[model samples]
Target: MIKKLLPFIGEYKLETILAPVMITIEVALELMIPFMMARIVDYGILGDGGMTYTIQMGSLMVLMAIIALIFGALSGRYAAIAGMGFAKNIREGLFKKIQTYSFANVDKFTTASLVTRLTTDVTNTQNSFMMVIRMAVRAPVMLIGATIMAVSINPQLSTVFIFSIPVLGTALYLIGKFAHPRFLDMLEKYDSLNEKVQDFIVNIRVVKAFVREDHEEEKFVDNAKRVKDAQLNAEKLVVLNMPIMQMTIYTSVVAILWFGGNMVIEGTFNIGELSSFIMYIMQVLISLMMLSMVFIMLIISRASFSRIVEGLEEKPVLDDGDADPQLKPENGDIEFKDVSFSYSDDAEHAVLNHVNLSIKSGETVGIIGGTGSSKSTLVQLIPRLYDVQSGEVHVAGRNVTQYKLNTLRDHVAMVLQNNVLFTGTIKENLKWGNEEATDEEVIEAAKAAQAHDFITAFPDGYDTELGQGGVNVSGGQKQRLTIARALLKQPKIVILDDSTSAVDTATDAAIREVFREHLNDVTTLIIAQRITSVSDADKIIVLEDGKINGFDTHDNLLKSNTIYQEIYESQSKGGGINE
Candidate 1:
């Protein structure tokens, strides 16, 4: 997991290397200051050396301190650069990986979970990375350096560390062992909290209309409290870290003071050497304290790092590695042979059964069914959005799996059941279909989708900016705008997945007419709730329980197919027969 994440350091390699080097230099120089102070006291003040030597040693100590400060600052600066750059690259990689995921892959991990991994989890990992580069090095070096100096001064006095150091180490190990699971539980609660908020926000309008704001607030509060409890549970164990250090720290100091005081009185150890030894003991204890803090950070971030790595290492549901790079879709022709698909592993609940169909280029077909007829599922196979569980789906005579995903999807445009528009001008959203589309091409596609007149009515015309999700437009207008965007692709195949249900019959009829005249060469499949929408098609398919119950001209289906008759009767009773 660590190896996979490290490669994202990319351009920050220099800073990653420099940060620890700078910190090592800083730690070394800082260690020398205490030794130099001991020289000033023992040699110059008490021994034969005069005040000049004291002043000289004092000046040298100050110079060392200044150099250490500069190096410390450089280490911090480098750590920040490396840490932030590593996180940025990780985010970019995660996002690009998500783009390649098949629909099945997306379903495996929910939206809220992915968002948490990208934001909060990444932040935690970044802080740990920077600390590891800086403090992780500093703590160990400081501890070893101080211990060596203290042992050199009085080997017997330094034994006090043996008892205190082991005690502190044991406490840290126990705390880390217990706190890891607590932190892991906390991050999962964060996912639940985020899901609660995201679900409420996406459906805010429905909540408002249903007068369920209080219900939502109560649910949110409950989830928020769970998150708080999980966090407190983890922190309570980590909070033990400092108190344990303090107890060990003060106990060692008291022992050193007592034994060394007796030694000083006997002239076995000089006052200056004792003073420097006490400083070294303090440094060693303080370094132990730093280690405890780093331990706590690593325990917490370990959970987050696991999550990020899990997401990063997830193989996309679809792989195009063996696909022919030059395999381009040349026509709108499509065929499905004995294809079977199930969202779950059980074959009894397959969303699409062994279905077979052939659609020729330029054929405009209508597909009619009840809610669970797998109308959308069938067309999704054509573009290779979801691969079949068994058998094959062919586009332009070649198996969809043979071509690169981009090559297959570029020629097949789909307007899904739930249309989405980003926060941008109408023209910008349309250009998503074709980035290089000319103004004339843009106007033509919009005109064909019956969006030009209403768009031109606005003051900004095509350049009018839309609010998020195109909230400024009505549902019907939003539908037409999505149609216009899809038409801009000029794709060889277009799938309208109940995309016109929001628009009125008149506008829907106009859009269909435009398809006939301008998109005549493209194979079009329309999924509709109303029979009139498909009543005039070149042919209509009636799907029942993932099987094709009937496929024929609209008139023949109405005459012979029971499922088609039932659908037509259900819709025509409203007096819009063949509208």
Candidate 2:
């Protein structure tokens, strides 16, 4: 895990080096302070009248204590800042990588899983990095220094140090190995819990409409309890390590005192030396405790690093088409010859099959079909949202696959069936279509989409914040705003996928009239379910089960096609269709 996270540190190598160096100095200073305390106790208070030596040693100890505190604080401050900055860079890099991924790659990892990776997992790795720098290096230095000092004081009693250190190391290793798998399980449970909560919030309206609040609560509780159980199991293993280590060190201390007491009575060991030995043993035990914490953090960080690598290594399925640089179409002529497409290899059937169509430049084409007739799927192919399995889709007189994606999409604009609005001002949303559009151009597009009147009535007008997903706006207003956004692009081709479904029939008619008058030079494709919606188009195509059944002008289709006549009759009987 340390190797994996090393690259994110980048130019902060100096900070990383300084943190450990400062910590080592602090540990050495701490060891000296304990020995000075023994000096103050044995020599200053009980020695032959020697005020000069006692005062000098005591003042030196105070100065060393102050220096230790300064180094410790500097080490902690630098480690924390470096860890936080490194984590921020990792998260930003991951987000940019995700943005470049195609739809197929994104589907491999769900939104909630990505969110967990970006936030909770990154935080875990960052905290571990901080702890390693702040304590991992200093602990070993303090332990080794204390051990050498104790052995030098009295080699006869050093046998207890060798016995206790090995026991502490073994106990920590065993507990860490057992707890590693449990921490990984806990991370998985957290992902599942996040997914459930996200789904509930997104579909809260449905849950309320069906009165399933209690059912959702039960589901959430079950997921939360699973996370709690995994966490508890891992914690039980980790908490046992501290006490076991303490017990081993305590036993060693008892043995040391027993041997050292005999030596004291036999006039072999000094009182000051024995006192310093006991203090060194305590320092070694605390150092072991810090080492144990480092190991536990390493286990948690390993799990988080795996998730980050998984996201970084994912491959986008869509390949960039090798496009011609000098290919520019003079008109918005479109053709699909024997087109067929399936979302994946395992899909049982194609969403579009052997479809054939042709539309002249600047023609208003209407696509009418029943539910699941693949109307939206057909239009999506023109923009290369999903490439066809066989056959060709030509746009502006060139194969779509042979044109650069940016160039091909630049000439086309689509308002999807599911209207989406970002959190921004009205003017900001419209400018998404054309970033450089002037205020005059924005208002013109809004009026063409029949959105100007309602927008002007708002207190802040175009500057009002829309809130998340435009929840502050009504459905009809949102659809019209989206249409205005698409209109501002001023593309050669426009596809409205049932965009006016929320407006009244009169408003829909007015919008269509505006399209005819102002956008006559641009080719328009309208996908709708209502017969009245497509009755005035220059051409209409009726689709059934992924195949075109009929294609003609509305007047000719009404006379020649029974399906068109039936749709018109049904809408007329229902006192006209809603927009």
Among all candidates shown, the one with the greatest TM-score: 1
lDDT of 2: 0.86
How accurate locally, in lDDT, is each candidate? 0.91, 0.86
Question: What TM-score should be assigned to candidate 2?
Answer: 0.90
Kindly give the stretch of ten consecutive residues in candidate 1 with the minimal lDDT sum: 570-579
lDDT of 2 by residue, 390-509 (tens): 899998777888876667777788999988999889999989999999999999999999999999999999898998788888888999999999999888889999998888888899
Report the C-alpha displacement of residue 358, candidate 2, in angstroms: 3.5
Q: What TM-score would every model get versus the actual structure?
A: 0.97, 0.90
Model 2, C-alpha of 262: deviation from truth (Å)? 3.6
True lDDT of residue 424, candidate 2: 88
* Residue pairs that clash (backbone atoms under 3 angstroms), model 1: none
Off by over 4 Å in 2: 38-49, 164-169, 321-331, 390-392, 397-408, 555-573, 576-579
